[model samples]
Target: MAFFGFKDFDRLSEVDLNIYRFFTANVDKVPYLRVRDIAREAHVSNSSVMRFIHKLGYDSFPEFKVSFRAEQQQAHPTNHQINFVTDQNFPTDIYEKIELVADRMQQADQVIFCAMGSSGALAEYAARQAAAVGFNAICVKDPFYPLVNQLKNTSDNLLIALSVSGKTIELLELLNNFINNEDVTLVAITAEPSSQVALMSRYVLGYSVPQQRIAKYYDLTTQVPALYLTEQLISTARRLAVQAGDHLI
Candidate 1:
C-alpha cells in the first residue's frame, strides 16, 4: 500500500498542475466533482479535465474520487494512543517513555511530524526516519498550505505535532483545520493535555519537562522531551516495517 517513488504525477504539465490546484482549493465544495464543474473551476474544457484525470491514473471522475478516498484511508489508520506528560521534572524512566512512543507510531499509517523552535528539529528527525523506512511521511512547518495540499492527494496521513506549552498559534491553526476534516488523523505531542493543541488533536502524547523562555532564542528546556519522543517514534516505525517486510529506504 506504499506509494514510494511513484512519479506518475511528477511529469505533470503546467496545465495539469493548475487543474490540480483548482480541485484542491475546492475539495470541500466538490466532494465528487463533475467534469463540467472541474472544467469551470480550472477554466479548461471538459475534454482537458478528462484527459488530466486519465493522466493522474483515473479511468473516470467517479472512479478517481473512489480511489482518492481509498488512498486517504490507507494512508491514515485509526488505531492510536495518547500520552499526557504533566511532570515538571525530567523523565526518569527512559525505557517506559520510549516504549509508549513506539506503541503509538506502530498504529499510525503515516506521520505528519511538526514542531516549533527546538521541537521542530525533533519533528524533522522523526519524519526522516519514517521516510527512510518507506513510510509515507511528511514534515510540516510554518508555511502549511503546501503540506495541506499534499495531504489532500494522499490517504491515511497521520499528523504528529509537537509543542511544549501546547499553545503555539501556527500549530493550533493547522490542527484546527485537520480537526474539522474527519478524514484526517491528528496526534499531538505536548506537555499539557489541556492546552489548545491537545484539545484539537485526536490523540495527545504528553511529556513532563521544564518550560523556559528566551528573549531572542528558541526555548530548549521544553524541547528535550519532544526530541526523545520523536526518536522513539522513528525507532518504532522502523521495527514495525521490518516485521511487515516493508523495510523503508
Candidate 2:
C-alpha cells in the first residue's frame, strides 16, 4: 500500500533519525543487513533499531526490509536491481532445474504461456523469444476463459505459467482445472516455491527472492527472474536440439 514517505521521517527521535539516515545512505546494503548489523552500523542498540522499525509503522524487521527494498527498487531501478543470475546459489540450483525441463520443451509440439498483469506482458515476450529460436509458442493475455477452453482440448503442449506470487486466482483456477491432463504438461515460474501454482504444476522453476508491491502500484520483482529463465531455457533447448540432430528452423 501507499505510505507517507518523507512525512513519516519527521516523526522519529534523534537515535531513530541516525539509524534512518544510515539506512537511506546505505540502502544498497539493506538486503544483506540484519538487525544487529543495522544497530552496529548506526551506533545504536538493537532495541533502538527495533523501535525505529516500529516507528516506521512496521511490525517486524523483515516487513520493514520489504518496504524499504521496494522503495529502493522504485527509486534506483536502473543497474541497482538485485542480480538473480550471478547470485551464489542461483547457478547451481536454478540451472539444474532448468535442465530437467529443457528436454520436455524440446519434445513439446506447442508452448503456451499464461499470465496476467505485468506477468502477461512477460509471457508475450517469452513467446516471441521462443519463436525466435524456432519453437511454436503463443501467449494468452486476457479473456483467459478462451485459453482455458483451448487448454482442455490441447495435448503435447507445455504451459508455462508466469506469476511472481503464483497466487493469481485466475491462473490458479486454470491450473486446478488443467492439472489432471497427462498429455498437457504444466510448469510454474514463480518466486514462492510453496505457492499454490507451484504445488499444482507438474514442474516448477522457482526464483527465491524478495518480491514486493511497492506503494500498492509498482511490483518490485518477477520480470528479471522470468526473463533470465526464458533466455536460459531457450538456449538450453537449442543446445539439446542440436545434440539430438534436430535443426531448429
The candidate that wins on lDDT is 2
TM-score for each candidate, following the candidate numbering? 0.55, 0.64
Error of 2 at 112 (Å): 0.6
lDDT of 1 by residue, 72-92 (tens): 556555675454343443345
> Model 2: which ten-residue window has the lowest total lDDT?
83-92
Which segments of model 1 are wrong by more than 4 Å?
A: 1-109, 216-218
Q: Residues 21-133, candidate 2: write the lDDT tens digits.
A: 89778878976899999899889999999987887778988888788888877876776655556554243578788887888899998898888778988899989988988
lDDT of 1 at 40: 85
* Full-model lDDT for every candidate: 0.70, 0.81
Clashing pairs in 2: none
- Model 2 TM-score relative to the real fold: 0.64
Best by TM-score: 2
